[model samples]
Structure formats: structure tokens, C-alpha cells
Target: MNVPAPAHLLSLATASPSHSMRQDEVLEAATQLFDGRFPQFERMAPVFKHAGVLTRQLAMPVEWYLQPRTWPERSAVYDEVALDLFCEAARRALDEAGLTGAEIDVIVTVSSTGLSTPSLQARAIARMGFRPDAAGIPVFGLGCAGGATGLGLAARLATAQPGCRVLLVCVELCSVAFRMEDFSKVDIISTAIFGDGAAACVLSTGADGFAAVAGYAEHTWPDTLDIMGWRVRPDGLAVVLARALPPFVRKEIRLAMERMLASQGLTVEDVDRFICHPGGMKVIEAIEGAFGLGQGALDRERDVLADHGNMSSPTVLFALDRIRQAGLPRRSVVTAMGPGFTTSTVTLAA
Candidate 1:
């Protein structure tokens, strides 16, 4: 059987905010803010150490999150920082692909941390210099799976259009959602593992590129809406993380991978490497376990987690960038899980 060629990945690039916070520094700050306020502060504080994050980029200084912030203030910061990060990442990707923003035929913007009336792509159209005719698609609520899902959608669009180019940009300013008043365990863990970052990639039907998108598939588990999502609040979005996440990954991810691969008549052994969303230390470990991979098999995932924390939708793209930099393997699988309890997977061929 012969397989048709899929969209080529022309370029990928990632950008982080200027301000950064070390894990220990954030731990101390969190302690100062949560102690005496939340009764379980001391017990939940250990999540900072166990999260496997050494440092993470922030849209603002660490002290900024310590203060009370209203929805308007947080939204303002999200608007400014998300735009800057998106433009920076998109510029780098376009430059690397040797193409201008005006050449893009389609733009897919993925985000979940904050709300924007015009959407990020719509707001940055003029700033990015994209053509007036280019189609803009803004995807939200996918959370961590947005990067892979957005890339898959972009590839599909480029494949359908043949000569057209598609740009996929994912930006998340998870830091802006920090809530001091709601000192739940989910909030504590989220504070320990969330950061601000952006990533962009170019895809086209042209053959000149590092890798081709072989296939893309997704699966949304039934009745799992509460597994992970945002709780709308007057102040800002509150993190809703269930403790069953790691165990869920361990039990369900491999089966999801199998089904996705089967759709293309491929299997786990056919993939030379796996680049996945590094949601956290436990999530990575669970993924490794599911795939029967040895411990620490996902070094790039760990490296990104240590350097940038979980930038929600952009984290998988950061791992993808690292994989490409290290020289892409002949066959690779990119996967990420998000709020829909959805698992998005993309198969790549070098």
C-alpha cells in the first residue's frame, strides 16, 4: 500500500517572556502568600519540589503575582504579553522558513489562558503583516492539546490547498491566571507548574522541509469534563486539576496511541521517537510507562519542563522544537492531552 504525502513542516520556533522564576524562589514566595491563609499550604507546598520544574518564564515579575489582581488587570496583562510573545514567535518561524507573514494563506491561533474579544490572530494580523485574504482560525479551550491539534488542523488546511502556506501559533500566559484568594491544592499545583510562553510553526504542501505530517488523530474521552479545565471566576480563571490525571494517562494514553496509529495502518514500533506535552513530572512518567519506554526516555520533555514549566497549549511545540533541533528522526509521534480529556496525536516522517 502506498501512502500519500502529507503537509511539510517548514519551521518551528518558541519564545519566552523576559522575566523568569526559579523553582525554589517561587516555592518561598508561594509559602509566604499561602501560609496562614490556606490550612493545607505546608502539605501542598511539596508539589513545587516534586513538579520537576527548575525554572519557568513569567509575563511579569514574581512579586507581581503575589498581589491581588482583578479580572481587568489580569486581562490587560494577558493581552499585552500574549501579543508580544505571539508576534515574536511568529516572526522567528517565518524567518526560519524564509517566508514573510504576507505569504501565509491561513493562520491558526491556539490559546486557553485568557480571553480576547478579537482573538490573538485577528488582533495581530496587521502587526504580523499577514495578507488581508488569509483565513484566521482561533481555537480555544483545548488547553494543553491545542498545539498538536492546531498543527494538525493547519496541516490539513495546507494539504487541501496544495500550494498554500499555513501558520500555527500557540500562546499561553498561564501566570496571569494566578489567584491568591483561592488557595486550593489545584491552585497550588498550578502555580508550581504553570508559565508563560509561545510557539509558532509553518506548514505547507511543498516537499522542501525537515519533516512531513504523515497523519493526525484525536480522541476525546466521555464524561471527563471535570478532569481538567478552567473555572470561570470574577477575578480570573481558576485552575481545575484532578489528582486522577496521572493514573488516567497511565491507563488510557497507550490505548489512545494505538487507535490513532491504527488509523494509518501503523503501530508503536514504527515510530522512532515520541515528542509529547510535558504536562508535569508525573504525567511524563505515566506516558513513559504507557509506551513501555525506559525511565527518562523523554529527555527533551524534561528539559523543557525544567526550563519553561507547562505553558499549556505551547508546551508540546517546545518539545517539538527541541526534537527538530536534535535532528528529527525518520518517524516520530507528537501527542498532547487537554481539557476535553482529549488526546491529540500527529505522526511525522523525516
Candidate 2:
């Protein structure tokens, strides 16, 4: 069952169903982490409800990833779990596309939670028996901006080569960095929000398919490093997510969208589909409220969140995959926010 080779595919490739921890499970875990030191759990009640997050998936079992152990133990677990996630996602995506590894030309990998020299891209290729000439490019430190950034790179390559095939893979094992001992508000929020997941897509310039890559634009906001990023310590990853991000999205994203569309000679009004990342409940609300997008602007986003929590780079890809599977209207604008405090938007003429 060969996937009817399309001209280009984005998030429309096949995706595995996301699994999550139950709500009671999260509350219990939060209780154990913050039960005595911080009474902020009650304060976060409304937030949990408002965010509509009942559950979130973990990259590894919480007990396993959060266990304090020697560096070797930690390294071993991270390596094992990250590989598991990468393989699961890669295989499912390939199967959905009805593709074998040999069909891929270039493998573009994206992730923020784990490190690897050969990277998941190489591992996937080697495990799946891909051709040796299949180039592998690993992108790190992009954080949430990775998916759009990967697509942007793919688009550039496809345009330059005029018929190239590229595989874009994103896998984030965020659970590997979970700090259950921390009761900080930001940490709590991150734990409750972030999830483990990966996504894969095949982008081609030669064939025509369900949705096509139209154009992409990226913008970096200055003076916002503290807005969101990681502070690596010997213990684990300490996430710094500012509360002001929601408002920032409302103010800056509109401007960014305008500039991105102008370069392509299009406007928001002309776009028939929106595949923006669900940064969180607030982030999604900020986008919708500011842009005055109709009710359906976030249909895919809501579905993805309910199904997969926040898989960072993979989240938006999952949303776009759902949208693509629905056979959405043509002319779409897909975007995501990442750590550079940067926003990347891609316009797709489906």
C-alpha cells in the first residue's frame, strides 16, 4: 500500500494515537511533589480546568525519570526511553505514508529534550534499512519552534532541488527531565502541560497531494530570552516559562502574521485553514482572541491537546496532521511559538 506519492505533504502524514496519564494521576503526582511546601495547588485548580487538560503523557515513567540516581543511571534511562519514542513514532508515520525507509532522500530531525550524535534520524534510517546516501540533519536548541523550523528548512531544500524528498521527524522526551521535587509555579505548570511525543512527515516537491507547502516566514523577538527556556543543572532541566507569554502572543503574533503573509502576497482573510500550535490553553486563546479568528480556527488545536497534551515540536505537527486528514480547504497558515521567543509561520496552498 504505497502512499499515493503526493507533490508535498506536511502534517498530513499518518500519526499514532497519543496516550496520557489520567487527571487523578496528575493531581496525585502534583500533590506528592508540592503537597507541603506550596499551597499553590489550590490556586492552580482553575487553571487546570480552564486549560481543559485532563491528562498528559510522560516520556518515561515518572518514577523512573524523576528518580535521583548517578549520572550513569540517568543517562541510561534517557537513552533507552528516547529511543523507544523515536522508534514508535517513526514506524507509525512510515506505515501511514505507506513508505519504506529506502524511499526517503533526506532525514531532518528535531528535538529539545534529548541529545544524540547519530540522532534519532540516523537511528531510524539505520534501523529501517534506508540508503546510505540518505542525508541526516539534526536540529537542536530550537525548542518548540522546531516543527515550523524543520518545515521551513524542508521547504527551502525542496524549492532549491525542485523535486527532492525530505523526512521531518520530531521527538521530545520531556518526561525525562521532570523534577517532581520542585513546587515552583512554573515547574508545576510545565509538568502539567508538557507531554512526550514525536511526529514524522515526508515532504516532496515533485508530486501533488492532499496539502502542499506554499511559503514560510520566521521572526525573532528581541529582549525575550527569559520568556521561556531551559536552565540545565546537575539535577535536571529547569524550565523558565514567563507568565507574560500569553499577552505577548496576542500583541506580536498578529504583526508577525501580517509580515509573513505580506511577503507571500496573501492575507489572513484569504487563508482557509489555520494550524497554529496549541502552546497552551492561554496561548491558543491569545491567538484566537487577538486575531478574531472564527470559532473553527482552533478546531484541530483543541483536538490535539485533548488527545496528546503538549508534545512541544510535535504538537503542532499533530494538529496539522489531523487537519490534513480531514481534507481541509486549501490555503492554510500554520505556525508555532518556541524558546527563541520566536514565531515561525508557514503558508500552505493545499
Query: Which candidate achieves the best TM-score against the true structure?
Result: 1
Report the lDDT tens digits of candidate 2 across residue range 1-350: 84333247733342332445865677676667676768877777455556656677775555664455544555565566666666666666667667778877887778887767657666666677678998888888888888888878877766666677777788776666666554578877776777777887777778665667778898988888999878886766677789999999988888888888899898778888678888788888899977888555697798787666777888888888787777767688878889988988877776
TM-score of each: 0.98, 0.91
In model 2, state the lDDT of residue 286: 90
How well is each residue in 1-350 modelled by candidate 1, as lDDT tens digits?
A: 95445799999999999998899999999889999999998878889999999999999998788789999999999889999999999999999999998999999999999899888888898898989899998888999999889889989999888878999999999999999895788888998999999999999987568899999999999999999999999898998899999999999989889998999999998999999999999999999999999899999999999999999999999999998898999999999999988999999999
Number of clashing pairs, model 2? Answer: 3
- What's the true lDDT of residue 53 in model 2? 63
Best by lDDT: 1
The C-alpha lDDT values of all candidates are 0.92, 0.74
lDDT of 2 at 196: 76
